[model samples]
Target: MQPPTLSLIGTTPRMRWAWTAAGVLLIAGWVHRPASAQEPAIFRGADLKLGEELIAQHRCAQCHAEKVGGDGSAIYRPLGVINNAGLLRGMVEQCNATLNFQMFPEEVTAVAAVLNRDHYRFKD
Candidate 1:
């Protein structure tokens, strides 16, 4: 008493091609999506490599180590004041201004993005 089952076994070659094309399109859409599409809106298109370089050039970890001791990674408290992408970016901007790093807005965003990827993991 099994119900009728739909099967592609006897389908036309054209129908098979259409199904293949649809699957390809779906996979391509997912694969070719912009990297920013997966990141927080504020950090969209931020250059992570530049951010890493800036962090080293500015000795940010060294400064943080001086402030909080250890490797300075402790300064990045995911459960502390910075709880979102926007706040994380603002904190980087604050550092830029306070330390007179002279970083552009995009640079600040880049730094914040690296931090988010490494620590905060903020989706929004």
Candidate 2:
């Protein structure tokens, strides 16, 4: 009886180089992947500072506080009906319309991005 054996000794130099390159590429892809890749595409390149400023300037927290009480963060409802990134952004747009904020499309995306980063944390 003979025991089975595994060997890479037969592999050519080119084959070994190819395998090494593949491994390096795979590792690099995982390492360089953007953290925001999981977030909705609409959130990409959004101005977070502008969003925070708008949120404060518009007194969103103040209004929410008046409606839901406390710091007003309770209205977020991560598990509530306003689930998903698109819906969250849409809600912000709705607020903009209803409040007559007249914010530009990028402004809406900014606000939604800030909200997603802080409250909703929607992945996509």
Check candidate 2 and list the clashing pairs: none
| Model 1 vs. true fold: TM | 0.73
For all predicted structures, in order, the TM-scores are: 0.73, 0.74
Error of 2 at 115 (Å): 0.4
True-structure RMSD, every candidate: 5.8, 6.4
What is the Cα root-mean-square deviation between model 1 and the actual structure?
Answer: 5.8
- C-alpha lDDT of all candidate models, in order: 0.89, 0.88
Best by TM-score: 2
